[model samples]
Target chain A: MAEVVTNLSRKEQVIRMAAELFKEKGYSAASMRDLAQKLGIEAASLYSHIKSKEEILRTLCFDMAAEFRTSLSEVEKQNVSASEKLRLGIIGHVKVMAKDLTASAVFMNEHRHLSQPWLRDFLLLRINYINRFKTIIEQGVSTGDFKKDIDTKLAVMTLFSSLNWMPGWFNPDSTIEPEKLGQQLADMLINGLKQNA
Target chain B: MAEVVTNLSRKEQVIRMAAELFKEKGYSAASMRDLAQKLGIEAASLYSHIKSKEEILRTLCFDMAAEFRTSLSEVEKQNVSASEKLRLGIIGHVKVMAKDLTASAVFMNEHRHLSQPWLRDFLLLRINYINRFKTIIEQGVSTGDFKKDIDTKLAVMTLFSSLNWMPGWFNPDSTIEPEKLGQQLADMLINGLKQNA
Candidate 1:
């Protein structure tokens, strides 16, 4: 039983290693053999854990999706205002990226590598996730908290685009704390870049 | 001489085809042979126009960089206020991305594929371009146009993060004109998202 549990964790280790490889070498270019090599195991041995390169890509993308949806669900349950929800959403999203940079990068950039059925489903999940933000912005507008004239679609795009791109340049070693960075982003998005009009 | 001119145009065509391929297949995964096949030419014939795959990537990235810097310079020359400059900057940036979606995607996503001195130079150019926005935001803060308490670095990150990610989701066929979309984004970024706050 202990050996079985260790094997299961080793399987997870394979996925984690694949995520880093995918992040560094990109999904299409990084072969399963390369992943196996990275793990100091024979190429055939990798099969015991993961099915194929596509499986790894699918796992990374969906796992990250699950992470975001989980966070969004938590935020949705809060009895906070739309503005506060937006703030928490940003923090949740950014923290996920900050904590798992490799998974986030792969999730954002390699979703297209997923094959059909999975690709279609993943894209749907992505759109639904984005719509969550859109719905929040709509709620804010309806409540007179957000500008009614603002394009809600464009606002959501701006917010998600900014949040999604964070993993690309965000450095864990940087002086800026991830939580603080999230707050600043929330402030800018919620308060606008302008001061006193 | 006519043949020579034709050859020159074919070289340009090779670069253009490579841009499309890089956008579709990604930089590292795309082979020169794939580009040649896409162009309906022999792989060896491709050598007459481009030296290597990296050369094509270099051309695309630097070319896009040049396009942006040119636009940024024009925006910089304007005697408008910092806020106006920022609005125009957003418009210019979005327009460029909209006009050349393939090249913009390559530039934004494939720059990491560039190697050596070229990579170093390209990153420097990118930083300088980002600093232009940082300077404008700083000027806004100094002039009390933007929130004084805002972190300038974070502000620049949020702005460029939003702008650079535009190519990923922007659909030229969409109802929103690129200029109008830019205006909406500028309005959101320049004015707070909250209404009547």
Candidate 2:
């Protein structure tokens, strides 16, 4: 049983290593053999943990998408206004990216690399997460919390696009603390960039 | 002479085809033979225009980087306030991405795959562009255009993060015009998502 558990963790490790390689090198370029070598195991030994390279890609993409959804869901439970929800979502997003940069990169950059059925499923999940933000914006507008002229579609796109790409440049050791980082992003999202009266 | 001209065009076509393939299939898996087949030419015929697959990648990545730099520089040339320059720079960026989605995608997503010298040059260009935004934010603070307490680093990061990922979702035909998109984005960057008094 212990061996089985260790084997499972080793499989998880392989998936993670492969996820980084896939995000960096892309799907068609990453190979089982390269992944096996990275893990210090024979290429054939990888079969014990995962069936194929596609499986690894699917796992990484799915897990990242799921994590994003869960994070947003958790944020929703807080007693915040619609605008604050948007802010919390951005904060949650950046935190997740900071915590797991590689996985976030894979989720953002390589979801299309998955095969047909998997791609559809992954996209479905992503679209759902996107809609959560959209609905929040709609609610804000309806309640007079957000500007009526606010293009919810474009606003959501702009907001999420800003938050989604944070992993590419966010360094934890930088001068900004994570808490402050979230606050500024919230400020940017809630208020306009221009100085208020 | 006419045949030679046709041959040159064909060779150029091969390079373009290879770039698309590289972006789609990646560098390693996108074999020269695959490129030749896509171009409906013999693999040997490809050498007249490009020396190797790596050379093609170099050209593609460099040209893409150059386009992004040129866009930013154009904004820099305009005699405007730092805030306005930042807005115009972002507009130029979105327009470039709109014009050349493939090149922009490859440039942003595939730079890490580049060899050392090429990679270094590309990173330098990227840093230059990033600094352009940072300088604008710094100026905004110095001139009292923006709040001094604003974390310029985070401000710049949020600004660019929103702009960098525009191409990923921007649709030229989806209602919002380029100028309007620029204004909205600028509003978000300068003012943020907060409601006004």
Candidate 3:
């Protein structure tokens, strides 16, 4: 069986290889030398494409934050009811994790280690993404599509936590497909098994 | 408010303080001198209580693994049905995260950095605790108590990914109490809101 050729850019290829190293071995444990070796280039050659390991992390975090924001935007554009929007929101969150697990992991785990001004900006983006979800949930509750008792804010946090951590466990090589995983997660979030009247 | 007195041993005290440093700053970034400085002791004097920073990490990992295992054992001892056992199992998992968030963080995040022997022991204990939940889930499904359509192993893993990650989001100061959080998560996992049967 022939392997599928993945057409990655020089920059994109570095990000992919760095993400694997960072995830398998935590950021500090994985070094520039190791990453350079994985890329089949000299350590000095890596600098031509990337400034530092920190930049690689920031790239991953920023790109994921962008993609996540984009997914939410797409969900917002759909002319659907609040409940369907919420379902789509869940789908969007899981799909991001599924499609870009490494970037998602870097965004979720390593962004906390970023320094001051950059960290603040990264956090602002993350909080905005979170609020986007919270607003959708709030709309669902107000529109009578979800239970009145639902704490829209806390529910969003719990839902995001559940969805964000999926990359740590999900294996793309496994039999479970991403869309199916999204649907199962969305079902659990929206209409948990208790029969709705 | 009166200051709460700590009843931890000198060694335990050292480990506790070190864990906070390790958690806030990644393990590689935290130093023995920094740990000793935090404890109000000379760096050389600290070796009397511990061999090195790695030793502190090993002790913390063992403490966390033990706490988790003990909680699972209590769940196992409960004279309840397999489904109820599963609920308690999840509750137990979340409780550990809430109560021992730092140690749990170190165990979950840093154990891979351990030397081979310690890593082997940590993995063994980790698997043992995981198997407890898997067995409970398997029993529940086989008894027709849980939705048999759900893969027991994946469901157990997903449940764990959800619970184990609570520390990243949970705040003790938050209005949501652990008990209520546990109950809500339990409901979401077990019953999922699929219109109440």
Candidate 4:
């Protein structure tokens, strides 16, 4: 058990370093040697831990997807109102992006570099993830919590677009904390910026 | 006059082809030779019309920026309610993206590839563009057309995020006409997606 924990931590370290490099140089331009130089490790040693750069990218994309899926699943199981569920889901998505800015950047930007069957699979996973939001919005409309006229697909797209673009602009040192920002976004999306009578 | 017209038409043809190539192969991997080959002209002849590959990128970015600025200027002159101004601003934005899908895609994706002083200028222009939205939303809040409790900056960011992302997913062939889709987005943003009593 101890040995396995140690090995996993070492792999995690490699992933961390790789994410920064990938984010800075882009996945296509970044090389294993560059990653090793950044890590102060021999290139061969880097290879021993991770099979290839593609593996690292695949891991990052799938891991981020898995984290989202797990979070959404938990949100799904909660016996909360549809609006609450949507809010929690948005918060969960923002928190994930906030937790690892570099990894999230790579996950969002480098998915285009993913090859073959994995590319197709990753896309389907993304669709499924988006559908979760759509389902929540649909439920809200059905329950009369959300505006019935709302285009569910467009609403989901808007929500995801707003949430996904965070890594591009979010500053970790900003005065607005991530959780608070998440709540603010949820409030705006649900209640809008216009005050009602 | 005829000769000048022909020359300008040829230049427009090159820009159009360049936009397509830039969108497909990306700014970095795309080359002058490839662009020339696509146009069935000698690479040197391509130089007679355009200075360099960077010139193409610069032209596309700045041209798109100019279009947005022009549209916003028109929107700014309208004597409408603050909410109406924002709606018009968004519609103008979507219309630009819808009209030139390829150029807009290149403008969004390849802005990072812009070199040196132009890159810095482009970044400033983007900030200026975003500030325009911020200003409109602020006006809405000041006039009580928007909720005072809303965070102006986040609201602007959310609006841009939603509008800017249209290029990534918008299918020109979709049955949803761009004008109607723009109206729908405006409605959602101005009035929260929640059902009101």
Q: What's the TM-score of every candidate structure?
A: 0.91, 0.88, 0.88, 0.89
By summed lDDT, which 10 consecutive residues of candidate 4 chain B come out lowest?
A: B188-197
Interface RMSD of 1: 3.6
Order of the predicted models by TM-score, top scorer first: 1, 4, 2, 3
Q: After superposition, how far is residue A59 of candidate 2 from its true place, in Å?
A: 1.6
Every candidate's DockQ is 0.51, 0.58, 0.45, 0.46
Better candidate number, 3 or 4, judged by TM-score = 4
Docking class of 1: medium
lDDT of 2 by residue, A1-197 (tens): 99989988888899889877876677777777888888899999999888877888788888878778899999889888887888888778777777778888877877777789898988889889999989988988887788777778877887877787776777757877666787788776677622232
- Model 1 clash tally? 0
Candidate 4 chain A minimal-lDDT segment of 10 residues: A188-197
Stretches of candidate 1 off by over 4 Å are A174-177, A193-197, B1-5, B193-197
lDDT of 4 by residue, A15-74 (tens): 999999888767766778898998898888997788887999999999998988898898
Question: How far is A21's C-alpha from truth in model 2 (Å)?
Answer: 3.0
Give lDDT tens digits, candidate 4, residues B64-156. Answer: 999998989899999998888989998988888898989998998778877789999999999998998888888877887877787888888
What TM-score does model 3 achieve against the real structure?
A: 0.88
What would the per-residue lDDT of candidate 3 be over residues A1-197, giving only the tens digit for each residue?
A: 12223323777899899999888787877889999999888988888878888888888888888888898999999999887888888877788788888878877877877788889999899888889878877777777777777656557766776787787778879888788888877766666422253
Evaluated with lDDT, which candidate comes out highest?
A: 1
CA lDDT for candidate 4 = 0.85
lDDT of each: 0.86, 0.77, 0.78, 0.85
- Residue-level lDDT of model 1, residues A19-97, one tens digit each, is 9999887887788889989999899999888788788888889989999999999999999988889899998998888
Per-residue CA lDDT of model 3 for B4-122, tens digit only, reads: 33323777888889989888877876778898899999889888777787988898888888888888899899989887887787777778778878888887777877898989989
Q: Judging by DockQ against the true structure, name the best candidate.
A: 2
